[model samples]
Target chain A: MQQQVDIGEVVLHHAADAYSFGIDPYFLLEWHAWEFMQLGPFNLTPTKHVIFMVIAALLVFLTMRVAGQKLQQQRANENAPKGFANAVEAMVLFVRNDVAIANIGQDGAKFAPFIMTLFFFILYMNLMGLIPFGATATGNLGVTAGLAIMAFVVIEISGVVKLGPVGYMRTIFPSIPGLSGPGAVAMSLFMAPIELLGKMVKPFALCVRLFGNMTAGHFVILSMMGIIFLFGHLTFWNWAIGISVATLILGIMMLEIFVATLQAYVFALLTAVFIGLMQHEH
Target chain B: MLLALLQEAETHGPNSPFEPEFGLIFWTLAVFAVLYWVLQKYAWPAIVGATEERERKIARQLEEAERMNAESQAALDEHKRLLAGAKEDARALIGEAKTVAEKEREGLLAKTRQEQEQILERAKREIEAELGKAIAELRRGAVDLSLAAASRLIDANLDDAANRKLVVEYLDSLEHSR
Candidate 1:
């Protein structure tokens, strides 16, 4: 009897975060959850995603640092940067000009660094999953949520600074034109929760959009590949199916790479837009 | 297969995508915070500062170029004005010189005419005086010849004063007749 392969289990196992880092078929580094660092409801354990997150952070840090030094040197000599430094400068300028200032207005220069950090960090995390034996840190809901929350904080704080306390309150409870007395009060009370929900939804959308896109791309690729193993035995039909699916996977991977870059851009762009929205009330 | 996965997903609660892991979130926040701080402090300043510096340098250079252009333009205008003024001055000088030369020529011509008139008047006066002298001398000789002729004809000497008076009267009569 041929044993059937459970594609669902395989996909879920690969998509989800694990304590073990699997390098190859034989090499696997198992990590035990840190029991002593349990504080309240949280267990601070080093997982696969955590390791990748650290790697991504380190990469972003080193790359930016080197690029920054090169830029400073080039500027001193009154010369343009070349190669890797130029590429990094291009990205940095795009985020500063197109994403930050374009959306967030003239005052967007202050938030450019934060937006740049988010963009590169998310980009690196997304690309990590595409490589062999590497996991996507951004694929995890928690990580995306964390990033979204930070963006949310920056957005709201920018509003508070721009609009002030009273003006910020007015954003949530807006006064309609030509409405007076009790009617205006009633309307303001009614619109408050909706306005607050609108604010919350921006970050929520940012979080789910990144997480869903990254996870779904991986899921589709894995499931398609798993289809070849469905036959259980290496028959001619199975081999043919495997070759066909592998070709399809290649195409999907190209799309995934595009999506990875796109999602990072979208996240940064939306965050800037949200910050811009907060700067001025409609 | 979808149903089977749903059932399996329901059983596997911890590994589910919807389930939140506090530890993962904590780590993410920690890593991100460190990244943001480090980058904001060190990396960003160098890159962004250089960009701003370059922009400032370009702006200043443009301003300087504009200033130089304006200055050169003003200088060119002044030079053109000076050239026009010099041309005008030269024309005026030539016109003045012509007027002076014409006046000097007229003055010289008038002086020459006055000197020519004076010389012609003196010559006329001298010629009249000489003509008067020559006529007197000729009259004296005519009287002498007449007396000698009369003496020879009469073969005697007559009184001179008496004959002279007669001769003078005869001459005066002759002059009146011509």
Candidate 2:
């Protein structure tokens, strides 16, 4: 049976270049505070909290890298991975093989660096959304779209690289360029827009997809919490029953773990596919 | 959707950073650089180094132990084979010596017995020669005595030849009867 969990809305503002509220693109872009700005326009916008996340990201990168480094030691190959490093390599290889390389290709290994990075990055960002007083960087479209744009750039550049100067346009369309039967022209015209739309929609789709999912989960959790307060004013019975919302909220919290990993995976997988598409034909 | 969302957001308020254009670009570049630099420099290397080092060390140790074990087992097997060979060699040597000693003893015994038989046979031959010489001498003595006795009994001038013949006949008769 499917469980219906309803979540409410999150208000985001675009009022200023340097908005201070959470979950807003304006704020994310404007994140640097005055103190951090003194260093030649470098963003000092990350709050101590954002700084914490930065720190967390750093730790993740370091931990994984160190593990990878040790694993790479030449003689170590004889023994194979062990302990924590074993576990970590297994995870990395699994993700690389099953999701990235499988969907992508051999050249896809290079993108493993990007995909793995994004997976952890987005995963942490999504998880950070749940923490009280924690900023969900993912809630902002600027961040998500920025990520999506990176994918777009990589994908387009990769496609161009794969198809080359003369063949690129041809690869995008089904028909030969000069042949113009009325049906052919019509078909090309129709397909061209659809192809254009498809290309344009990819990043936008990714942006909205990730943004909706992350934001929705948070809102659902928040709404469940709001229920207690929403009903708290009415009756003793309402207050008591509303307390049960805590359990449901906890349940959602658990579900958030699954959602977080899944979103991170989908995002990374899509990135690989996008990157892979550059080198590969339909 | 971002544009639409922004347009809707525009309805909410008069905004300063009105567009995502340069704002996102600048921040993304900034954030990515900073994160990459900091992580690659201070954080990533260390953590990756540690984990990889750990994995490598564990792997190395396992390999070392395995190699050592194999070497030891090989040495043990060699030693056992050597020991067995040595034992077999010792037994063979002992058996060989025993055969050699038995052949020597038989040869020595046969040599001594042959020498003893030769000495006894020579002594018997010498004694037999001496006895034969003694018997001849006795016969000469007997002839002299008999000649003296016959001369006294003959009464002087009887013919020596006749006496000699009588003596000879008597000797011959005695020999036949004996």
Candidate 3:
């Protein structure tokens, strides 16, 4: 008898956040959500994505802490860092100089820590999904939205701090050049919603871009893997298809790694740009 | 078949990626907040501070190196200038010494020549005087011999002063003729 493979079920099961961790036919660890704390309108249950998020956070914190310490030690010794510390330093400097400072101008260094944290945290979360028995926390919409919302808050707050309340209002209601009186006022009124939408869109794009890229990569890999088992019988064609699909999946996995890093960089870069734009409105 | 699969995926209602799970968002916020707070409190300061310090140190070192290079170059230029001045001074001193030595040698040579000429003139005057005296003595001896022969011939003594005067007049005539 040919085994039935529900491709959609397999893909959804792997791609979506779940309250249980499963390796399928080998091991399964299901969580009882009711056992966890329940606040008003909030369930503090540890889902697969949440657990992965913690792992990612812990990984980032510990690694960065070590890197930070090593950096301090290297500074004290007045010598360059080596190996992992060096790599971390390079990344930190890149985010500081290229991402944050490059986008945000002189005051960008103040925002470097936030940008660097977002980058590494998102990076680790994206990478975790590729590992066996690991789920991508960033693949979840809620997680990406949370990150985006935080970034949005930072961007807007920085803008507010840099440009006073009146100046921030001017950002929404920009003065049109060469036009004054009623014309400029009409232009400002017309541009106001657009400016506000533009503000919201920056973070929205950051959220969806990251979430989509991560989730889509996993979907493609799972769908490709599903193709091999789609044929009912184990034949020569099936083995050939399996081999081809595996190769394709490997290629995609490589691309996914690149995409993960790219998405992380994009998010950080866009956030920096938004902060910069807010600081310097014209 | 793919469309059917997608439709089937859509049927799994709660699993839709678009569906916002408040629990997951809350967890994300909590985790991210904690991570951010922890990192901001500890890791970021060290990393950023160290990196900035390293940058400042590198810039300072470069500035120091440039300054040192300029200082060394200036010192080298000063040293060269001093060396040139010393060389010029030494050359002038040598030239002066040569001129002084040349003048002193010329003066000593002139004095030595004058002394040699005077010695030659004195020796010539002395030889001439000695010759004149020898000649006078020889003439006196000849006259005395002549007088003695004459007296012997005459076989008598004549007046001494008159005879002497006669013999001197004869000898003067004979010397004049020779």
TM-score top scorer:
1
- Which model, 1 or 3, shows the larger DockQ? 1
DockQ ranking, best first? 1, 3, 2
For lDDT, the strongest prediction is 1
Error of 2 at A225 (Å): 1.2
Q: Once model 2 is optimally superposed onto the true structure by TM-score, how far is the C-alpha of residue B64 displaced, in angstroms?
A: 28
RMSD of each: 8.1, 13.8, 10.7
Which residues of candidate 1, in runs, are more than 4 Å off?
A1-3, A76-78, A232-234, B56-178
List native contact recovery per candidate, as a fraction of 1.
0.62, 0.20, 0.65
Instruction: Tell me the TM-score of model 2.
Output: 0.55
Docking class of 2: incorrect
Q: lDDT by residue for model 2 over A173-242, one digit each (tens)?
A: 6574677788776777678777878888988888778877876676677666667655656655775757
User: Which digits, one per residue and each the tens of the lDDT, describe model 1 over residues A147-215?
Assistant: 999899999989889999989899899988999999999999999999999999999999999999999
Tell me the tens digit of each residue's lDDT in model 3 across B94-125: 99999999999999999999999999999999
- Comparing 2 with 3 on lDDT, the higher-scoring candidate is 3
Superposition TM-score, candidate 3 onto the true structure: 0.70
Position A222, candidate 3: lDDT: 89
- Label model 1 with its docking quality class: acceptable
Give the Cα RMSD of candidate 1: 8.1
